[model samples]
Target: MSIRRRLGTTLVASASAAVSLLSAGQALADDFSYNPPGTLVSGSGSGRFDETIYAPGMRFPIEEAPAFLNSQVWGHGGGSGPGGSQCDVENFSYPWWDNYCETRSWDMPLCPSGQGHQGQDIRAKSCEKNVHWVVAAEAGSVTNIGSYSVYITAADGTRYDYLHMGSVQVSVGQDVEKGQHIGKVSNEFGGTPTTVHMHFNLRQNVAGVGNVYVPPYLSLVTSYQALIGPPVEPAVGSLDEVSCDAIRGWTQSPSSPEAPIDVRLYFDGGPDTAIGHPFLADLSREDLCTAIGSCEHAFQVPPPLSLYDGVDHVVHATASDGSSNAPEVANSPMTMNCAFELPSGVRRRVADLDSANAWHFSPFWDEIAVSDGILSTIDEGEDLDRTPRLVATSSAPETLYLVDGGWRRAVSDEIVGVAWQFHPMGAEIISDEELAALPAGKPLRARPIVLRSASGDLWLVDDAPGPGSTGPGGLGGSGDDGDGATPDGDGDDVSGSCDCVVGRAPASSAWTTVFAAFVAAGVARRRLARGRRGTRP
Candidate 1:
């Protein structure tokens, strides 16, 4: 047997060898119930009850269901004390158990006693070994392989360890996708066999602490729910209205009708598609109060500027109750046809003179102003598009500016890189004179687009990059159809891990380098508007 597995079984089994696993209480599969975190079998020691889902959108490791997630050593199996066959019917049943912090001697800071089992042990559908397959829980590259262990490390540095498996199909340094098969479950612990099961571990760096193992039961439960449909119906609500001004809605859980629920609004697609955000349904509504005995069940937020582009933008509102199943509000998927047109013949371009680039926008360009205050005779420049791409200046490469409605608004690197892709070296060098002449408007702020990760958590992602590409002379330069923006509304600033500072330019369009999948960090709100257009320096 593996050194850790043998140590774990000895510690946990000897402590509770006389206690039947059934004594923990019977949990039905339908209820998806389980003992609360830290509620281990008697003598197994306490477990970590931390509820944070460190891994969102992870895939269930088992390739198929009928597999049971219960204690291997403490169950009615042939190990320390109980002499029942490991294939007993009770061994392959639900609800799942939390053995992450079961009794052990390993160094585990997250555990209550500072040392315990580092992961959860799961039994396959039956007692047969080397038949049930185990797959990758998240997309990552295989970093290590042992005689009976495999480790995959994600791009973000989170490591996933799978042990006690046979027929290994992956080698060290091989990239694997979530749900991809790695090997079959077996009792292969070096040269000795322990029990027919798979042991899984999650390791990542935590602030104020070094790399360590975290609780994985909650993440496994979420992913398992995704694998099998939710047992209960999702919360219900209504998308009361979707107007040119604001989108309003109300949501309530049948399980708890009087409590206000959270809702998410998606544009042009379901929860998995397009841009969306979450709004609290805690606003008061007399109609809802009369119907459900709760007044604080309404949600209302102004329509995003992206949806007012003279087209049908479908907005769907669904309850966000941290469940796999997401039920849309009644009258959902309503269309928001708020048309905001851009002025025709507006000249928008990055005027380049030497290494300096100036982003200039005007309703009508009567003439061109080049170096030395010379009004040079130039042909008609290109017109600005509806949604202008974000840009930066050579002088201030760290800051990205959004030009819209005849105004230039400073955008943070968070929005420029992670939320929406922009050229790192996309800043155009403009003369100081031209830069001072451009007017600054309100910061280009908009509501964050909420995205659901593998762990079933809703994260606020910023908007996607706009319609145009950057060129040799900066944005809208030669060989690319550069665009500009118009219109505005209120939204929270985004936060992310990618810095996206100006550096080497990629050999693609301006908005080609997408820096996606970052958690939203709320930036301090800036003043409503900055310097006005044409305001003399």
Candidate 2:
């Protein structure tokens, strides 16, 4: 069957969005946040949509109370920053743009010059989809529900657009109030899912100009501040082991990356030490992933960083607890960081589809290849039983996803989209003509392969082209940089300071909402928060 046919009904069929909008008297003061507690601004999606496709939208003057109150909608994640390749139009065709872009570029034809990323991308507390709520930022009427997005029109005629939802709760003409549950967070992007993030945008109908992008960062920050009060200490419970190439650690707290924005190591109490960002390390480590929902983290340094050059270096960690002035978690190195026995290359397989825990792939059934960063025909006689061997290492083409061919990927016996879903060895994507051209026994290519976001996971895609904004642990903003994310907020807030809205929200109740599980990553649907929660990867 076609990929869409296989996945259409798989996800989001049961998300609680089926509940209709409240009949009347919708409250106006939605002082509370719509996103669950601990949500972050991971990708910080650009509003480049207006910059590239539509006319310029109105910009909110951050300091103005009216704008702040009007733009009080919140995003889903905890991290934010200037990520490399946030607007990766290179892999795809022309005109289409991602949600966020700070350093604007419009040189490409059919694209405007000054328009940058307009909206910000928020992440649910975890990468797992569906668990997070896509609540209405303000009381508004649902105007449009396209395959890829949900457009809610606010009282002022401004539009708050939410993208990539697993399931849309509100329908056209339904009225919604701020913090009203509208949909669930998801990887749904029409057909092409772009990572697990909620792409939020604020559009204004400028009389002569159509709906345009109004910078929503300040309002988002204010909303985030209102939702999550003062920053608390990062929950860095313990250090596992340290090595030259990677620093392994865990947190007793709720760690997906477990608290702390950036984990820094001060070598020898000296001025310059190595800063190793974290990622999902060794998925086979069941104990950690089970107890902490995959809290295992590692900072793998690239070759050029001389910091790991052998001499004994004392190391301690300084972590930011997603707050402005929280005390840093000072943890001394439990063990020296080393690169010994590390894979040095990223290798994802049908097995990484190890969700649901029903069936698992044997190590031999899986394999790693030096992709040479381009698409290639699978080895002629390969099967699940054979170890994966690199057939294309010298080519410099970009890394590509194989056609969706796995029956096992659909845990619920439903197909999500085809992108990134693993197919068996023989069914490479090829044209019908190319299929005829192939040797009698060779497999034929059938569909388009998608690109995996480039995080700093050196194991599988270290050599893959396009070091994208999706950083290690899939949290956007490769923390390996000096300062992870600049506010890119409105007015003075754009500077290093995370300007708090003073008393917009009460400090006593720190995190307001409590989230449970995520939506299906591929199919774009999620179980109801009331249903059996899926284990987040």
Best by lDDT: 1
Clash tally for model 2: 58
Instruction: Give a tens-digit lDDT track for model 1, residues 3-40.
Output: 23443443334324223233322333455555666667
Superposed model 2: Cα runs more than 4 Å off: 1-100, 103-113, 206-210, 230-537
Q: Which stretches of candidate 1 lie over 4 Å from their true place?
A: 1-31, 230-537
Q: What is the lDDT of residue 445 in candidate 1?
A: 30
The lDDT values for all models are: 0.57, 0.34
**Against the true structure, what is each candidate's TM-score?**
0.44, 0.27
Residue-by-residue lDDT tens digits, candidate 2, 1-537:
322232234333212111111111121223332332112223332222231222111112111111111110222111233322211111111111233443234422112334454565554432335655777765568999998789987645668888888767778988765567777767787676365557787787654555567645445544444354444333554444444323434333333354223344444542122323322122123455465565333222111122322345565554423322212243555434221111112233222333211122211111112222321221111112122221101121111122112210111110111112222221233333332222221111111111122332112211122221222121122212211111111111111221212222212211010000011111122112212133233
Please give the TM-score that candidate 2 achieves against the real structure: 0.27
